[model samples]
Target: MEPELFIPARALSKFVYCPRLFHLEQAQGYWRDSEETRLGSHVHRVVDRPGSGLPPLQAIRAEGWRTRSVRLSSAELGVVAVCDVVEGVGDRTCPVEYRRGGPAPGGGPWPSERAQVLLQILLLVRHGYRCDHGCIWYDRVRRRVEVPWTWEAEREVLEALSEARAVAERAEPPPPLKHSNRCPGCALLGVCMPDEINELAGRDPEPPRRLLARDPDRFPCYVTEPGSTVGVRNGRIVVARGRERQLSMRLRDVLHLVLAGPVQLSSQAVHALAEQGSPVVWTSTGGWLKAVAVPVAGKHVELRRRQYTTSPAQGVDFARAIVLGKIRNCRTLLRRNGSLAASDRARLDDAIKRASRAEAVSTLLGVEGSAAAAYFQALPGAFRSDNRLPAPLFEQTGRTRRPPLDPVSCLLSYLYALLVKDLTVACYALGLDPYFGLYHRPRYGRPALVLDLAEEFRPLIADSTALTLINNRQADGGMFEVHPTAVALTRGGRRTVITAYERRLATEAVHPVFGYKLTYRRTLEVQARMFAAYLLDEIPRYTPCTTR
Candidate 1:
């Protein structure tokens, strides 16, 4: 087995409880604090420390039992663990694992808790130690529940090790547990979002309100000031405005950070962030990713494999909803901006119908392209600008990406770049492979999953932001620079557009299917992860996000 596939003995309980939870914590390096986790931490603190009453492990049987907090490893077992206590009486030794809660309601130990101790015993046996029994010391109950090392119990331990290794070795995180009761208050709830993804996968997601607790203070930070510098000062991230230290924040409070050009980040700060497993991305002044600082510990090896190896038939089936969602959103945006004439509206509707009925990805791609053509042609009508765009630029016969031909074109391209970054971050958080795409053809460095995710939000997020800025007079001709071969946003123009983009992400909208209010940023992540769940066969189907 590869070194990366090694499973810590303590994680057996988590793996037994839920493989997805185990993957999220051990593979992805995510943890959320809650009352229960805190209480467990407090309990561990007492048992974790070596104290006056506890005896060393080697000095045994005679003067009662000896105990110690010990680290044991077995290369053959591919396991290493720190047992809370190991007690010996003459030749026989027993491992005692600590838990925060009391014994099982009927007096038997929980299967997961027993598996944890069983793993420690297995490791001990492989390490040439005489270990025949174990017990769980529930702090709340203040008593030990005996677990004799029966062959069946030891067999369970071996099976769990293999099962856990398979899940950890997979390309994606394991599927969410079927029941929502397992989700509420679990430390990984926010990142896992089992209910939200289940809902998108056509399962009874139960209710999100029951599964997740929305945190207002958990938004990612954006640093756009060009001359500012970010560094570590006294264990917190500090920002200096030119020569003046102006801001400070704890690393834990920052979920993500986007840096614009000319902003400097010290090596120490970068290392600190990487150590904490936070994503620090550097974007071009134009919002393109010049580089990204990612944590090395987590990557879903199997998810990308399945993403690219998907059969053409399955690819089209999953992507059909994405294309239809985009087309319908285009129609809605046209109406929102007063550009949807009866004929143009009818055309968009027809495109949507074709997109929905399309059986092949090739056919879907064609319908999507046509819908975009008409959508962009009506761009000038959406923006109430006096300076009409150049005829060659505004003709909008197709979407111009590289060296976007006009101001609206430039805005759309830049906004799509932003969406790519967003989808990329969401992908990493959910353990999905970003470079390998499911529906889009495999391409080097293109982030196919990112592109697949951007489809639904193209009109709802990027187009809507553009129309609001242009039509409401927030940005104008002077704000965009028209070069000999290309158009781009001026510094102030970029800031204005990005500010509006962030605002749109922050704005609350009722999720059409779930009928719940959530920020678009949250909605974007949920959509990406739901697609992941669909790919893993945890959900029956993938449902794309659609706006009314």
Candidate 2:
């Protein structure tokens, strides 16, 4: 008889939140990228460093943890999980997590982190160790608090695990959660527009009501009351007093009035006309705030509080750091250069470094043409750089071609696809207008919000996977193809790439910041929150991981 395997309670919770997320994570294996994520990776690396002399699980030792990404398999849950950090604390082995953002005091660990930690505990128990408690270290407050793994927590984790397994066993992605905020934050937001999808499904089809919130500095639109005398009628807005008989008035001509009844104005109607870039006036039966120019923009158009005071100088530094960090990581990954050469590495590095030190995000690239060219040059092959993979990768999904596809092209397309999907999701989740991006700048129909969030992790998540895939030889030319029209991965090609990607993520690597190792999936979420904090100015700058 075989030993009964115990699945970690964490993966289960992830499945509950979004089945597709769990599948991409545990089943198929996908990674996300952004500068925010890179900062998180750098922080975690500091914690997981082994020689720092920090007690096992107390925090990461400076020497770095022997490993950061540790894979554990459980027969009971039919699930395999990767832990962030696992170390011997006294006689008991413990798992310590470093979160990018702080959770609410009574909120416990986030469903995501809790699930990850629970999985670690289960893995230890499988090894005949008694595991009960875990720690969640938050960077914002810079505190590590213990999460008691009680029987109730165990039960919840188990329940979540069962559901996660079921989700991974499926072929296609799961449907979006009903009106969930997560939908907007996902990289797949554009691909899975929940609101539009729901409307099309005839579920929650009617748009929600918009009760106007008060903002005094609004463009004057006509307000009507009873018994007011006629001024002039333009068929748009009319003001009057009612209950007996009332006359219409042109908003521009109306001056003052006496209220005989309730005052009413068309807030939506006014907004619609305003949004058309048309001029409109406002007047009231009682008293009207005169409309001067009939403001072309809506009253809601206000600079973001977070961005309002940020100087170009400061923003430039932040953007520079992000670009340089990405270039640095790319160089680090490429030094071993199975496909991309040392010359290629230097070119890529110089390109991003120049951009980073530039006066602005847009001009950063223009300042150094060589660096810019290098950065663009490296993009095509970064995914299939052939520096970090194993051979004979599995292909369960049949998503890619079988042989001789351009490794560089395939990797590039896949990364673009993921980035596009992620950007779409982030836009919806943040409730920001998608067309605007601080870094990428606003483009017509582009979800700049997605681009902004995704920028912080591109190196850490997507780039890491590409390196792993090519270097390991698990996925190669066989997994991709380029048509005269377009480049894409076949189902088998996709499956092989994803399987290897997941396996690599499950591989343990040491953290330098938190003295732990976390699965790539968990790391992506952590990075997302950290970027949110950065945008909110909770953190001053983003820092990416650098090798000694």
Candidate 3:
């Protein structure tokens, strides 16, 4: 028989606070560090260290002892915990739990904290040690709040464990708490997406709370210089060519490591990055996403199962929504930045209508194709006509890929590739199979799901970034190396485009549906999660991100 699943004592606390949060962290294996969690870890440094072992209850009664970081487990209770501190004296023992922040508003322990300590006390009692009470050491307040064990507290703990176990056994997480004040300070606020999910699910009429922060301080580190090596030294990622140091950045500040072309990363650096949950993305010389090195795949097996088992009709419905959103966003981009002609505008409007009405993926593809043709025909109007560079810089080459025939098409292809890489990483981080998709059929080597997601953002992100580079004169003709067969960006040109792309990602815009502003980078993850919610049937429908 399979052994019973033992719930961690700490997870009990989270389950008490928010069942969905607990489910996301424990069952789904989703975690993102925040300021509050960082501070908590800092405060836990001392008590986290292993200390003197605790003797048996008889020896403890005889000699009164104190131990730090004591590991305890109870098979009967199906619970395990690493108690921070345990003090004993003459047949009495107490578990002391450490908290980074102060006590609750009433100068008492929170319910979650109480439940955690109670479980710890129960574990001690089951192990033949007398534990009547537990103490919570609040580092912020510099005081201890005592929680005396009682029959009622024990019942509460047992009930919470039962509920948490049920939640774990289920394929989907419980619905989020309704407008609770507890969500703001939660470490998994971005992952749980309580407000956004509630609002989207039609359970809440109010707009989503703008709790997610804007652009994060950490940014992607791109290495484009050929023959350069990336390694870790003194907690910093160092890039060097030969014996000369090229760049050094604190490892903490790096979101991920991007290796373009022939860049080399040391194994030690790879191990360090993996430990920190930062993936290493490898791309071809022309920016095609080749592989991603992560410590492990995402743990949400249910979501992937749902993705692979989706019916063709449901797939077409989802694909239609995505295509409609993409076409609408494309029109919005043209109207906002370019001098869209009446004929081209009419064609785009008609295409959007047809795309919305399209029933099959083939029909949707046809509608999207026509819409893109009209959109790109007017895309050149978005460029600056007065720029004194070569006329080829601003010329409209229609939309060419693979071996782009002109500089404009070349830049667009490169930016689209970067966008693909970002979405692919997002898919991996969220535990979705990047190769499986609704709109785009699964193929070897292609991230079909990522491509499907990227369609809507192509105009708003990649195309807009390319336009910014060309119209602002940030990219000149010299950046391109034109060959008879193909056009590619030089190292300097790649750097320039990458900088521009990063800036566009960092730019904040109001989410059309949620009505809260977040960086485009953050929005991508939010959209990915929304897609997951849709697949799990938490939300009625998938809504692609469309900026106004």
Candidate 4:
């Protein structure tokens, strides 16, 4: 028989507030920290600590006693809880729960908060303690509200427990609360994508609310200097080279840790980044993604189950959407930046039509190849004439990889690597397997899903960044080391390109379907979550982000 699933008392509170949020956290093991959650942790700092101040239940008498972080469980109720604070006097006990925000407008405890306290009291009673009521201390208002115990409250708690268990047993979560105000402040707003999913599912004719922040506060911390040592010190990441300090940054401000070339990262640093949900990406000196160490918490078995069980027809349909978006975006780039001949433009338009009509993955592949060849032939026309470099550098025949044959190819390849790395990190954050993909066939040591998603973004992000670098004279032939067979960027060139690439990611653009502005970096995760929602059948179809 399967082991009993012990629901946490806090989870019951979540269910009472929003069943979909509870399902995302408790069932799928997904979580994202927000300002409110951080403040709540601060409010509970003292109460989160365990102390053996209170005597045992049998020894309790007239003297009042209190204990912090008291652990209790009830197998009969299938519940476990860590009461923030437990106080008792003369055989009567109460659980004291702490809240970061103020009480309800009417100065009463919210139903979810009351349910949490009630469950705690029930657990205490089951463990042979006499508990009559509970308290909720709202730190923000500096007020305490009493939640008196009664049969009705007890019944509500029990019914909520039964409902939560039922929801957990299902393969998919319950529908999101329609047009609810709670979603705006929710910590998982981006992960849940309630409004976006509703819009895509055709249940809502209006556009999705711009709930997600325009840009993340934290950014990637890159250590590119060779022979550097990365270590954690006082909740900060310290980078040094043989006792010479290079840079120091607070751990919270770092989105991920990127170690390129021969840098060494201490175990403590790795553990710290993992705990913060920031992946550690390892890359070669030439910017090739070698490996990644992501947090284990990102593993969501349910989503992976859906991914593995996808039908061939579904896979082909998804692949078509990805390729179609890519070809259209590529054509858009040519029109906006490059001086495309009528024939070249017509060829691209034809490729887009063929891609849309192609039923087989093989046919789509051929269409994509044909489109890429025509697109690259005209790409060089977009570059401005530079006195600092030879014309041959910009006038490349076609896109080249595996030791790019020209400076333009070299820069494009490096930018693509950066793009793939970001997409891989986004996939892991959403609990999706980056190696398994719908369009790109899975291959050993290849991030197929990352490539699959990168298709739509290649022209918009990577190619655009590369073009900006060339047109602005930010990159030139002097920054490249040309051997007989291969061309690569020098260290200085890599730094310049990386800085420009990050700038491009931070630049804002209006989302095509949502009609709201967001940075390229934020859009990556949003698109990834939309794909996840599609896999779980939350949305009827997965729409790729396309540039206008």
Candidate 2 wrongly placed segments (more than 4 Å): 1-311, 338-353, 367-369, 375-407, 419-435, 476-478, 504-515, 545-548
Pairing residues by index, what is the TM-score of model 3?
0.96
For all predicted structures, in order, the TM-scores are 0.82, 0.37, 0.96, 0.97
Best-first order by lDDT: 4, 3, 1, 2
Higher-lDDT candidate of 2 and 3 = 3
lDDT of 1 by residue, 253-341 (tens): 77677898889889998888876567888898888876666676335645556665777777888889888888888888888778888
TM-score of 4: 0.97
Tens-digit per-residue lDDT, 1-548, candidate 2? 33243334454655666776665444433433334555777777865554422243445344533345566676655656656666653456667777778876584667777777776787667666556787788888888777777788778777776666566655444544666666655544432334433433445545422111111111222233333433333443444455443444344322222221244445553554333322333322212222222322211121234444456765676566655655665565555444357687667766765675577777754543455345445444544444432222222111233232345435644554444443343333332344555555667655564555555456556666666666566664455555543344554666565455545434454333333455544344334434434444434554543332
How big is the positional error of residue 57 in model 3, measured in Å on the Cα after superposition? 3.1
Model 3, range 1-548, lDDT digits (tens) per residue? Answer: 32277899999999998999889988888877778988988998998999986777556655677889999987777789999999988889999999988898889899898889999998888888877899999998899999998888888888888888888878999999988999999988888889889988989887788888887668899988889999999999999999999999999898889998899899999988987789899999889988997666678898899999998888988898889889888888888885678998899889988988888999998888888878887888887876423434434456777888778888889999999999888888888999999999898887899999998899889999988887798778778887776678888889999999999999999988888788999988888888899899899888888876
For candidate 4, the C-alpha RMSD (Å) to the true structure equals: 1.6
Candidate 4 residues lying further than 4 Å off, grouped into runs, are 1-3, 390-397
Taken over the whole model, the C-alpha lDDT of each candidate is 0.76, 0.50, 0.87, 0.87
Candidate 3 global CA lDDT score: 0.87
lDDT of 1 at 462: 88
* Lowest lDDT 10-residue stretch of candidate 2: 209-218
| Better candidate number, 1 or 2, judged by lDDT | 1
